[model samples]
Target: MRAYLATSIGVACTAVLVLPLSLPAGALAASPAAPPSGRDAGVRTGPGAHSAAAAVPGSTESVPLRPLGSTRAPGGIAEQGVAAREVRPFSLVGVVWDDADDELRGTVQVRTRAVGSHVWSDWLEVETHNQEHGADPGTQERDSGTVRGSTAPLWVGDSDGVELRVRAAEEEDETGPVRPLLPRGLRLELVDPGEEPEALPYPPSQNSPETRPGAESGTATGAESGTATGTPVSLGTGVSPASGTMTGELAGPAAMSAEDRASSAANEGLTELGAAEIPALTKAAVAAQQPDVAAKAYAAPRPRIITRKGWGANESLREKRFGYTSTVKAAFVHHSATGNNYTCKQSPSVLRGIYRYHVKSSGWRDIGYNFAVDKCGNIYEGRAGGVAKPVLGAHTLGFNTNTTGIAVLGSYGGTNPPAAATTAVAKLTAWKLGLHGRNPRAKVTLTSGGSGKYGKGARVSLNTISGHRDGFRTDCPGSRLYGKLGTVRTSAARYQGR
Candidate 1:
């Protein structure tokens, strides 16, 4: 049965009073003596030796404790218990003892080998008796006690010895009386091996198959020995067939199946483009167009992109750097709070300020958006370009992960966005939609519940563009600017068709 050393009140007392027990002859020396108050007893090791040095403070040595089988006391009461049957001679396992309360309780097991001999099959029994007078006139009152059953054998002795065999009472059984079985004061003996060899459980088997040797054995067969026949095979298990086995030859690209050839062609196409492809395309397109008079578009200097400093650089922005492939299910717009009272030329400074606040002070690595538009209608880049390539940005909670981030430069909450800025944003949107092969004027549905501010109504696809507050909890783009999302989309469509 599973048994562990229990530290109950009885166990505590047992640990306390068991001190001062005498050591067996040749047992290791007693530990440093304990004070009269029984405090500061250090750890003890030797058999039947009480060592204050070995005892922990406030702890006492426990008497040998054991569990007996379930049985009823002579009376009708059901009692379950165990007895310490025998202590082996010269055995390292120790004797039993009781505390000041006269309670017989505590675990007794083999101590470490350094201090005592390991003895197997050892035990100590305990019982209590009534004091009575016998016929002998000169004799004082005598004490006679009844016998309790033996404890299960605990293994002890050399490395091969049986360890302590402990058992516990079943749940249905009651613990027997401590009084009669264990007297207030009684010395327990330590037992050891005699002469007859201990009874072993089962003789070890010598015919196990694993111990055999040869090519046919369970062990691995090497290539030189050539025990295996057939082609070398690489099963996922790492087993390879013997050498001189035939494996199919590799197929050349020309010999590939139709599907494989098609896949290879696609991969080659992707590799043909270099890192500068997107930027070059953007520059060429802008150069071919006339600056919109309404937006007053002009070329802006490209800012030097900074990588996150220090160890933070290692974090990947692959998703942000490469645009992700997503259905342009909807579009969201917002105004940079810092640009509330600023003009288009001040956009760079605003961006720098945002970077300082988010990256330097707030510990973010980069500005978190896909693109930013200025009052002059110039579209400035934000976040790693790759994120815009195929992945959405984290601009708005919940919706940002799926929607593209487009920030306008000024506060539009109450006042309308600059006509130039609005017109520029429209032209930019048309260009982007064309690149994705979508018609800017396509009829689409806009759901208000996603952002929660708009009332329910069916709007055209051009009306799908929404302000940031439409999908997130924010006063983005100002109250005046946010309401014009539909108009911006319609204007962008008209410009693209023109």
Candidate 2:
């Protein structure tokens, strides 16, 4: 009889051979000095005699039988027997980070061992999914000593649990030459493993559950849960045992007010202000305007009302602009300060001013941007549509060489631009993206010429519009207006239908 053992650590695996004891026939023979009981000789035997006979073979049998303890049967000696082997246990290690649900998510490492072998095969499968009902399973191969997985872009609830499984080919199988053993390990780790949990913003109406915590029985609407009463509710922020309307010390940016959340979403292009909310937001922008703020709006020279001077009103200008032929691979956004405290009606003059600045100050022959938007959200022609002919402008450094640029009025860096402004940016961005056959939400970056500052290139998306600071080194737009670039970008993306 023999036994085997295996062990593993990190990438190294090893196995050891365990020797078993050999029992002789003579050792199992009954002792001659012991008196034979009646039962021992097929007669009425006492308990002592029966015990001795059980431990030793009788004279009638030439070979004595011995009990095997935690040992495998001898090879080539077939008989009904059992064998026990000790194999090394496998281990998994990894780190988790905050996911969309305010839950913790991360990667994991996996390894296994076999009896009597030092080499481990990379033949393992890994999968992960939320423990909640109706969750999809994500699968991956164990590559380069690690397995990675991620959750969906929404909260998976308080009991967000993950399961992992492992399988290997078995040693023997009569049906085939080999069989596979199914051994699995389930790790129920908290997504947010930090000692102090952070708060997560409520999911959007599209992805949020419909029912509020205290609502009576009702049907769930897609990701959102609906209550008997007509209101919908979001899962409480962060992962915890308590379930109800979220209230307590807020943590992280998730604690922001509804206005702040709306601002953030608008900047990110994740959501647009509702139509009803747009008017109020516009009024707020008008009221929020500070008189002391630099009023450089009327600094630029106004365009002549003759023949073809203003945007769409000029027929000769349209004839001069080129048609859209070259692929518009990227886009750049800017702000115009030509008309101080101007309304949407002044959009034409604003476009003319931008066109002049690009030609006169930047040495560009035409307006740099493809489009321009006013404070009231009116979209005007700049390069592509202002004239019939294409007019390339020098806008983004290295990037604008073949990119399209769009300019909006007023400085967004200081305060949140009006809803109208954001809406116009979104519509214009979406239209341009559709015309150019590009994704509005896709990220754009300047690959050459500009300094590595701002992460080596100006990385932006079509959905989230930007001011001049996002790419070029100079502050073409004032600092107050430039500060809100991210918010504007987000808001624009949301409007782009992302």
- Best-matching candidate per TM-score: 1
How much lDDT does candidate 2 score?
A: 0.29
Q: What is the TM-score of each candidate against the true structure?
A: 0.34, 0.32
lDDT of 1 by residue, 1-498 (tens): 011111111231011112232333335333224342221122222221232233221222223333344543333212222232222222212222233123222333332231233332222211111110011111110011111112111212222121232222223236744212332223222222222212211121111111111112212233211112222221111112231121222132675542233211211211111111111112122212323332213211111111121001111211111223243445567665432334333344444333322222112223455566666555554553231232334354334323456777544444567765665555555544433334444544543212223333323233346666655445665576666666677765544442
Cα deviation of 436 in candidate 2 (Å)? 3.8
Instruction: Kindly provide the TM-score of model 1 when superposed on the true structure, using C-alpha atoms.
Output: 0.34
- Local distance difference test, candidate 1: 0.32
Q: Which regions in candidate 1 have their CA more than 4 angstroms from the true location?
A: 1-327, 362-365, 439-463
Task: Give model 2's TM-score versus the native structure.
Answer: 0.32
Question: Model 2, stretches more than 4 Å misplaced?
Answer: 1-325, 356-363, 384-391, 412-416, 449-465, 476-496
